[model samples]
Target: MDEADWLAARFEEQRPHLRAVAYRMLGSQAEADDAVQNSWLRLSGADTADVDNLAGWLTTVVARECLKMLRTRRSRREEPIGDTTAEPSAGDHDVNDPEAEALLADSVGPALMVVLDNLAPAERIAFVLHDIFAVPFDEIAAILERSPAATRQLASRARRRVQGATPPRQVDITRQRQVVQAFLTALREGDFDGLLAVLDPDVLLRDGSAELTPGAAGLLRGARAVGAHALAFSRAARFVQPALVNGAVGLAIVPRGRLIGALGLTFRHDKIVVIEMIADPERLRHVGLAAVGP
Candidate 1:
């Protein structure tokens, strides 16, 4: 009815898009919410009487906040990464609620989030806006304070890495689930050969690359080594269940219905070629594993 009420209503309308932008930029639900809140604080304090496009203005504000947050997160590289899960631990948002579930699922997937985390703050801003949300390069450039050409380049680099991390493949979801289930069943039964049977002879198990702990293994070549590691971690398999990882059927390690981590499997010729396990608490918490679980 009044000026303040009209402004509040306008902000509420763009809140979803703002949160989505912040979530993709920051990769944490809490941080995303914080970024959105920060944007509102800025808008409330600033004079937006002359601002023609409130939507674009708010997006830029939220993006700037997210960029600052990303830089802060990167500075504390030495700090132990806390466990992040699809289920926002804040408890303010109920996972059982469909609206809450939609927000949780918006962060691509846990595995992709980890890769996106590796990108520099600006590159992430560029990629997430242009690649994920289809924001124009010129608008993103203004937010990053870089030339449109530079912003486009940043998005290109980030896109290449994202595409590289997740090699494009037409995976059969049903068959992949069966393979994952078979592997898990064998793992529980301690069937080493059975584990090898489901895996490619040249299977790759890439445990850690910038995730939870500094001591995580980089890569394990050959089925035997991969199987041995699988057996070693088999005790945790009881908690694992079939789920989608980056749009493909994989497994989520949910102990007591809490998402601990996710495994992204790459299948070739009906055999597992790559197994990427993300168990770090910080990275795990941001992933939407809880949303796709059994």
Candidate 2:
């Protein structure tokens, strides 16, 4: 194969990684694709015969483009942080864009992406490179034009900001049934703080009910985010009754004794970690509903 073909192949391999980095940096599908495309354009024109680290080179290129986009948005006062944009679809790349795929298995959650969007451009780049991509701080220092110590500070600040936005680092599912019960009670009462207290720090709540939108959204994470969601839909909790799901404690959506939905929760150290809320009537028939007296 010729040098051009080899180069194209090499870039394709790195596209997924590049896309993941861009998504975390920009938090917009269209913007991330633009950054990745710009990076390829730059790569095609650059003299890379002597370049040793192609991945690092492309990463640096993409980071610069994302940084420019962030700064421009900030200057124009067009801050689009945490709006209702649909989350990035992991492992799904634009056929033409090629670099829009997210990191597999470990794609950034909707809650975390909201936090990253709030960070400054340089802080976001430093954090993504060093913390997310595992790029060395010394190398990131060069990218951000800061000393190693300052670079570390940027990542540190960004890390702290993210921590504040995310759930607690540990999971406690020992009394998961009790936790789920309390969660339901809290939801019924519209006690947002009480509900958050029982959710895993990074709880993933996926609602695939026939009554609502028909897709798995990357939204609903952390206690606060999940709590807000639960509170918003608290009216539904009033009709939920305890049930046996796969021999574990679960919730059945019963309004006036008519079964409609099933919520089987996964716990970690007394916390609700993963909430599987299924509202499809056909699927509900398989949940083995049994009532618990209030």
Candidate 3:
């Protein structure tokens, strides 16, 4: 084969890994695909006869492209974050497909995606490369144009935000997670008894979404009433995942990679006493949401 054909083959081989890296950095499949395509363009034009690791070189190129896109996105923050813009759909390939986006969201995890969106461009790049992909700090330092120590600090800061420090509060968080997980599991499985187990006898559920149930309206009182409503809308459980709502364990309703709503839970004596559904676009954009786990 000719040199061009040889390079094309190599580029095709690295496309998957490169796309994965870009997706983590940008949190959008279409943007990630664009970044990877731009990287291929750079590779086709550059002379890499002396380059020992082609994968590393291509990764750096993709990273730079994603960083530019992120900076541009930050500058163009005209609309609110969770205003429910339609996802782009074109060809049959995974990049623009809604089903593919849902699968990717499930794999990388909705909570992580939500948290990564809140990170700064440099912090996101540093944390994803060093912590998630296992890239060296020195290499990441070069990407950020900072010293190795500084790059490490960037990742450290992101790490603390993502994983959180294990203090006394952590114990409470673990207990909360257990209750939330059980609540989710029961709701999804349609286990009425299980739902009652995690719910307090006098549980209160307040839903802010416009489409409130007929009689229930905005507020639901008592465990039996709340459990019944949960079963009625249990289909939404498929899109829900555990997340940190204002520094406590809760649920994030992410569908097709877009965070439409969140369930902020308040617990008392190992039971969920209050479940507030925040679906108002204004509240979703401003609420403090993050990944709940490492």
Candidate 4:
């Protein structure tokens, strides 16, 4: 076969892995696709005579492209507006689906991804490549432009943070739905005490457009706060529908049935600890709900 045919075969074999790596690094499917396409373009034009490990070379190229995209993305800035308080319109109901919910409810389980978000870009890249994908430190060092020891140190720090962190406890979908229903009921009825019964003692409440309130000084510590936060939102929210978020049971709140906001819940020991509410439009697009079915 000619070099062109040989290269095409090689690219096909490595495409899936390359896409996976890019997706994890960039945290956006669209961006990952772009990075992978760029890698293929570069490979198709390069001299293949001296290429020893095609797979490794392709991965390196993709990683470098992802890093470049990150740099370019960082250079652009846009002001953020926090106006998620408005009620959702009728379009919100159209995005609900049983099948999509089931799929997302199963595949997007929380683990390293959550903790990875907290790390700096370089640290995250180092940890993901070395720990998650088992890429060699030498390759990671080359990608990050740091010494191998430094890359090791970065991975070490990231590992410590992940190890020390608490894993989210699992919550059954039926029970979660019940909790949301009860919380909403109390809110509609103007019964704060009823709402308090359904929440964990260390519950967290966050408005989609505002910064989250820490656990130190909040209403209804634990369960009580959980109930109170639900109540607060229910009072103004037009509809609270349960949906799957990153493979977890979550709620999408719509005021007047429009697509306004969503909340991702992480349960630990049957208590909700991580409640991530996305009211930012840019972040919402990543949640994959814009095209969901009714």
Candidate 3 per-residue lDDT, tens place, 10-98, comes to: 99867767866887788654477689999999999999999999999999999999888888888986211221111112122246555
For residues 23-60, what per-residue lDDT tens digits would candidate 2 score against the true structure? 77887644776898999999988899999999999999
Rank candidates by lDDT, best first.
3, 1, 2, 4
Whole-structure CA lDDT of model 2 = 0.71
Question: Model 4 off-target regions past 4 Å?
Answer: 72-109, 167-294
Best-to-worst TM-score order: 1, 2, 4, 3
Error of model 2, residue 203, in angstroms: 28
Model 1, 260-286: lDDT tens per residue? 788867676778887777777764654
lDDT of 1: 0.74
Q: Which candidate leads the pack in lDDT?
A: 3
User: What C-alpha lDDT, on a 0 to 100 scale, does residue 168 get in candidate 1?
Assistant: 33
Q: Can you give the lDDT of residue 15 in candidate 4?
A: 67
Question: After superposing candidate 3, which stretches have Cα over 4 Å from the reference?
Answer: 78-107, 165-294
lDDT of 3 at 93: 28
lDDT tens digits by residue: candidate 4, 99-210: 2233223222344445555666777788767775789999999999999999999999988987887754434656655666665567778687876665556665544465
* Model 1, TM vs. native: 0.53
Question: Who is ahead in TM-score, 2 or 3?
Answer: 2
The CA lDDT at 127 in model 3 is 92
